[model samples]
Target: MSTTYKVPIGPVHVGLKEPVTAWLELDGERIVGARVRPGAIHRGIEFMARERNPIQVIYLSERICGICSFSHVLCFIRAIEDLAGMTVPVRGQYIRTLVLELERVHSHLLWAGVACYTIGFDSAFHLGMQLRERVMDILELLTGNRVNYGVATFGGVRWDVTPELAKAMREMIRYYRREFTPFRDIVMDDPIAHARMRGVGVLTGEEAVRYSATGPTARASGLRIDLRKSSPYEAYGDIPVEPIVPQDHFGAARGDVLDRFAVRVMEVYQSLDVLEKVLDGLPEGPYAAEANLNKVLASLKKAEGTGWGIIEAPRGDDTHVVHLKGGDENVYWWKVRAPTYANAVSWPLMFRGNELADAPLIINSIDPCISCMERMMVTDGRGDPRVVTRAELLERCRRKTFDMMGRRA
Candidate 1:
């Protein structure tokens, strides 16, 4: 008879990048069952939006995720524009698309490097990180900041693609095309990488659908679903994007860690193509419909309706909904549904029947941003609701850390 033991992978673990707890039921080294508990950090960003006007929320949304900050900002801005009935100029649309693809490249590179690091492939990891700087440099040249780029605005982008910026972007695209393949081949062609990743952390196509997995997670499982292709928005309408699936390229979609890795690697190439198209067909017009902030706010003040903005973010479909009250200058209520929230649902399924050592790789396979997905509401033992203040939360964090270190705070 076999006796099962319970093991916890995280809340704070060396293997994880972010704080998330996974309780695993193990029989020896093999995982029997798993339960994932997120919400280690609750930012309360959506709740904070209620106090600020539409214009102020743009910056707030950008802080949602460092890698995909612009995705959140664009999504939030689009939601507000939807309610306000504002139109983005043609040039603005193309510029928005350009930034979106650039962000995708940046995000994929970071994730790939992190994935390599998770598996102890340090050389590939370093190469990926080095390759990522090129895109970041172009992003900084265009928006003046690499992360949390304050580029997207209410009606359109705050910045325009000048001739110098365009030349830099083209150069960056060519650099990636020439340099990225060697790094990708380093891992993908390695027998040791195949031994570790192939057939590990499997989530079948049926499982992906049942769990409502989106983005590359779903695509890795052989689902040909891409929001850019299905519901074309922004520049995706102009530039055609076909979803990259494992079966299409590798002859079969095993829906394992390897497939997920392949999907993301291929996407880097796809983004390069999209960036080229965006630059070649770049339009000439006002980048922002109305650059005057006061007028944009004044127009939004009178608009009273709920609007949604959904886009194919780097991870997956990012959705934002905003409601504006007629007389109120501040946003009435706001909600965000990030891609990690959807992709995380399939984690337990992937964890089943895998080794305990594979836990970290499986969790990191989704490229999850725990901060983007966490939303917490505190309550007492009797189910009585209570608000946990910022200072209280900080104290709790300190106490937890001290306790873990076998000390009293």
Candidate 2:
């Protein structure tokens, strides 16, 4: 006698603006099987960069996603800079590190809010968002814009954080102590939160290692590979690093939602620690090598060769590859492999055999960036799931408008 029946979860709700679906076989509300329906939004962000010119492409990179905008630019710029055989100034590197860490704080807080919402803790969601707003404010003050801050440019930064902003980082850290510590205690130490999470969705250390997971996911599962330490891009190598590990960094890494959550919480603190060190020895130099637009354009001279650059983006490792061609409009091929590529692979393993109730918890635990994930469509029958996207709908509207025209050329 068998009592397992299929119960579908997601195309996640408003709690997470990302679209995702999980098919779980349930035995009276207990999950017996699971499958992650991810291809819903693979908008082809990966291959799109190849079509645009390098200088003209920074803006397109910015549109990759609002939350991880700077990191996207950082990755692409690092790749292009490597191709040009150029190195940014030491001060510029420090500035880039600070920007990256600030973005990390911003992103972690945003994830905290979304996680809270997924778990139905609305108050915590609002609190996390409010604190997250502080980091966003800092970004705007330094970058001259909110969201897609175009602060990173090849060979260096587009803008500098003045003395005023440097001071603000210290005070803001103090304010965040009040906001994050309490929230951290509740999410990390509270029994209720633990009951909801804890061993509910356990990804063993071996599984995490075998899957090649990175960032907090791997860290949570006890995989110790933060690219900052291993690869040491930018100036992370210059500053000392303390792993935001569980069980005090020496214990066996826990591959669970709580462990993943705790690693991220502690990582925010470590980011601040790194930034303070970078600032203490912040260098001084011109951001980009060229002094004027003509010089900058001339610097992009197409060379016949191939190269690659890899950066530790906020979500994880993001790589960019370039193959120079003699006359291929600036360069030959620019390829980027964002962290999501590896992160998504772990979803199936994470969700499988987990209870249907823990779908959201596990999905967000990998922290799949849907905007980064791209296209979203409901692939199941009887759902009448309006599988229309803004592009398709707009194209249809444009087609109708052209057909309605009384005169045509």
Candidate 3:
């Protein structure tokens, strides 16, 4: 006779850095079924955006996900620009592309490191983070901040990359190119990594499409859909981007963890090449228009249209929709759909029929960012359940912000 039981992984787990509650149906070491519960850390960003002006909303969007902060802000700005029928200068477009690709490099490197740590390779994880610092430093130099990178605004970027900064970025790219071989060898060629990752979380191309997966997750399954390639934005139209599929380096698509890893590493190279092209063809013009906030606010108040923005974030497509009220500076309504939300449905499919030990790696392979999910649950350790109101949560967040700022000062 066979016995089956349920195992709950987390709202918190040793293997996962973020809170994702996964319920697995296990028969001994193998998993027969799986269900993931997200929304443990929702921040209600879209609702809050209705209270802020367009300028404030840009910064608000960045708080959605730290790893892909630039992607969110860019999408929000694009939506605002489209609504107002504003034109960003050619130079501004190139600058946005530069920062966007730099963020991609940083995000992928971070994911690679996390993947190593999840599989119990500490040395490789440290090395990946050490290399990632270079990208962070470049981003800090360009945007004045490393993580949030508050660069994009309504019509154009708030800051411009100087010629010297551009030179430094080129040098950084060259250094990364030279160092990539060893990094690739460690992650791709290691026998242990191959044994652990290959064929572990296989999601077929059909499954990926059905789930509406985007970014590396979809491409790893041989789906040729990249917003940069299929739906060009920013400077991507000026410099074409070719979609990188898993089969290019892996020979054939298995749609497994290994294929996702290969696709991300391959994309680092592609992003580097695209960065170089943007730099070489960068035009000369004003980086940002005049900062007349009152005028901008007046225009926004009078504007009564809906705008949609979609961009390929490091993980996948990040979309934002904005509806401007006819007589208010604040937005009437706003909605955000992150890639993780789309991929969340596909987790059960990947987790089905996989070993319990492989669960963490498979979950992380999607680059799941639960922070972007608009849900939150507060758990009290006692036997009794407690009800927390939304006002209380918002106040708690505000207090934390003040405390953080006070500490910084």
Candidate 4:
């Protein structure tokens, strides 16, 4: 007779960066079923967006997730621009594309680092993070911020990449091109990485479609549905955009953890190439269209309309829907659907039939962002501490950091 038990990891786990609870039902060593709960960090961003004016909402949207911040604002701004029937300057379009690609490089690098760490490869994890800093430095140069780059504005970008900055970006890409080969070799040649990743957390193409998985997760499962190519927003239409499904890189897509990692790594190269092309042919025009917010708001008030916008964020397609109120500066309705929401559906499928020991790597493979998918968490006072004072919270944070550092040491 087989024995069954349940294993609960997180609400706070060393493996996860955000708040997520995973309950796994195990039969011996294998997981028979799993449930993932998200949303302890929900701040009602959509509701908050409805309260702010269009201009203010740009900043509000940017706060959706620190990593996907620019994508959020871009989707929101594009929705507003579409509602108002405004055109973005050509150079503005190019710059927007450039910033987004740079963001992709950084995001992918960050995920790669996390994946490495999850697999217990500290060297690759550190190397991935170190290489990622160059991308962050460029982001800082362009937007004056390392995270939450507030560059995309309504109908255009706030800052232009000057000739010198463009040159610097080119050099950065060149450096990445030189360094990526060794990184790829390290991940691909490692027998342990293959043993751990291949055939693990396999999601078939049919299953991926059923769950509506997106980004590298869906691409790994042989879905060729990148919004950049399918929808063609911003400069995607002007430049040829190719979706890197797993089969394109590997002979056949296994739709496993290894395939997901391969797709993201290949995408970093593709984004670097796209950046070069966008910069080389960057059109000459103003960074932002000349228009006063008051005039734009008046027009929107007189002729209110609903608009929907979608952009291929690093993780996947991020979408926004907005309805402008007649004779008001604020929107009547605002909706945001992030990639994590779509990808969340596949978690249970990935965890089923896998070992409990593989939980963290399987979870990391999807790159779950619980913060983006807001829900509710209830804690009963019957057996729990009611209030967590600031001192406790601070001490807990410090202890976690110290533990992590100790492990590193």
Candidate 5:
């Protein structure tokens, strides 16, 4: 018998691009053990509240991640609204939900593209990206920007939807469904696809619960939990969120790559269902509250207050924690959290015993978006540095003199 050798996966390399580092103790082809460390993209945004006002905070908060920015701003505003006792108009709620769903569609589509690319399926990846362009167009038309949709305000939305605009959105979505149909088949119904994914990374329900996994990772393990249903935010509470138990769609996956693929395809349909409901229920009124930017800023002169908000980000349940203490000083403590926190914790469980080559596929299952919000280590990794991973990003990063660049090849 040959002696088992260890392998180093990251801390800087590309192809499987990510800032996350993993040390795999391998006995030949089998993983004897694995060590994970994340946190390469820490921005120290947590303490910026002491220097920024509530309005200015929105801009800073949007810096979290392009994909999760809207959710980040929405959750933060919700928390501040909770403290200020601000109630958005009925119209605002509907618009907020619409914008979020659009964001949801955008995020899922982007991931679908990335997921397809992860497995070397470029055709599916291009289709996903092509379809995502329509979603971005819708966002740009409605919110004036795509990715970081700054459409959310503390008490309401920054934009409004008209009948013509709504009709335009409907038309665009219908057209994209045509593209989604063929690609969905190519990814989901392909036998080879299942062979690669179906039972590859099997994290059972019990293990998922023990690890406190949330979002798709937990869903793949057969857990039926969605913050939209339990917490009831925006229009999701009013919209139908049927869990695709034996099927896939933001619900459960078989804890494998294919299961992850299936979840995204189904979510596309569910998101459309939500958009229809929002359009039907949207009430006519002011899109945002009349809070003066300057006055609101002045009122926020209070030295300190603590607030927190949670939203279902594209990757999973994104959460934010805020703390402030009244003082004359220019620095106040503010903390931000992302869904990557929960998903990152679940990595070790998924990686253990998995084959060496399967590491990227397994990590992609969480659709981990390590760059969202801020990266933090709940607890320190044994002796090495922390490397963040989320949303199927597996490119090993290489640090250069001027910058850390991901080498995908």
Candidate 6:
């Protein structure tokens, strides 16, 4: 009989983008079992929401994930709108969709590059990064910020698609159409890439459903589920979107790392199509229902109820739940369930039978955002749960900082 050993692959591994631990039961180089431990990077974002009003929380929501910042903001705003009975203008809806697709393109390109880098395909990685800059440039031109764009507001978008901005968008669409295919082809056609990825982290369609996998993670497993396609919202209602599945492009959805990669690559093209449709169908009207912030806040003060917003974020479906108390200016409570929370559940399933070297690729196949998924929970040494007040948390942080400084000195 072979000896079995336990090895922890994270909390601070170079291969992982965020702080998450995977304790692997290894027999030689092959993984026999795995347990994922997250929460190393929890920031208590949901708890922070209680102190801020709806407007202040928008910026806080944006900070949840730099790549899909708008998704969080939109979801949070939609929840608030649901309670307030607010409706965004048609022009605003189209603009919101435009930004959403742009964000998707940005997110997919970044992930694709990182995926290449993870497998030591540095040439393709660099090219992918270079290609990504064009979309970021367009985003900056439109919103004045490349990452946490303060674009989406409660009722509608803060900025309109100016004629010049519209021209830039059209140019960007053409640029990606001409350039992106070759980059995708480079990796998809590479034999070494196939050797590294194909059949390496298999998660079946049935397994994905069982695990509640979302976004590309689920689609890669051949699940025909995309919120944009199934439950159309905003401009998606006007410009229909079909979920991209591996079986449709390839003969079969092997439900492995390669299939996940292919699904995201194909979805980039799908986003481009959506972007074009949004531009063509752009309407003329006010972007926000009420541009005045004070008035919006005042109206929200009288509303009291629980509201939920769910949207197809870059990685998967992003959900936000908010509760408001009547006559209260601050948000009573809030909860966020990011895609990584759902996709990470299947990590152990993917890890089974895979080699030690393939751990990073499989973890990354879901394009996880650890910061988005993390939630704070304090417990005593005896395992009894306890609530740490904000003051106590701050004191602990300061003490830790001082200790680190003294050690360095």
Model 4 residue 84 lDDT? 82
Per-model C-alpha RMSD: 8.3, 8.4, 7.6, 10.5, 8.7, 8.0
How far off is model 1, as Cα RMSD? Answer: 8.3
Sorted by lDDT, highest first, which candidate order results? 6, 1, 3, 4, 2, 5
Q: Work out candidate 5's RMSD over C-alphas.
A: 8.7
Q: For model 3, state the Cα shift of residue 119 in Å.
A: 0.5
lDDT winner: 6
Tell me model 6's lDDT, rounded to 2 decimals: 0.93
Between candidates 2 and 5, which one is better according to lDDT? 2
Tens digits of per-residue lDDT, candidate 6, 1-409, equal 9999999999999899999999999999999999888868878888888899999999999999988999999999999998888999999999999999999999999999999999999999999999999999999999999999999888999999998999999999999999999999999999999999999899999999999999999999999999998878788999999999988889899899999999999999999999999999899888888999899999999988889899999999999988888899999878899999999999999999999999999999999999999866677989665667789999998997698568545
Q: Could you arrange the candidates by TM-score from highest to lowest?
A: 6, 1, 3, 4, 5, 2
**Tens digits of lDDT, candidate 2, 108-128:** 888877777777778888988
Candidate 1 lDDT, 280-362, residue by residue in tens = 99988799999888998889999988899999899999999888888899998788999999999899999989999899999
TM-score of each: 0.93, 0.86, 0.91, 0.90, 0.86, 0.93
| Cα RMSD of predicted structure 4 | 10.5
lDDT of model 1 at residue 194?
Answer: 86
Per-residue lDDT of candidate 3, residues 120-168 (tens digit):
8889999999999999999999988889988888777888888899899
Clashes of 5: 35
lDDT of 2 at 40: 62
Q: Cα deviation in Å at residue 319, candidate 5?
A: 1.3
Candidate 4, 131-221: lDDT as tens digits: 9999999999999999988898777888889998999999999999999879878987899988989999999999999989998899999
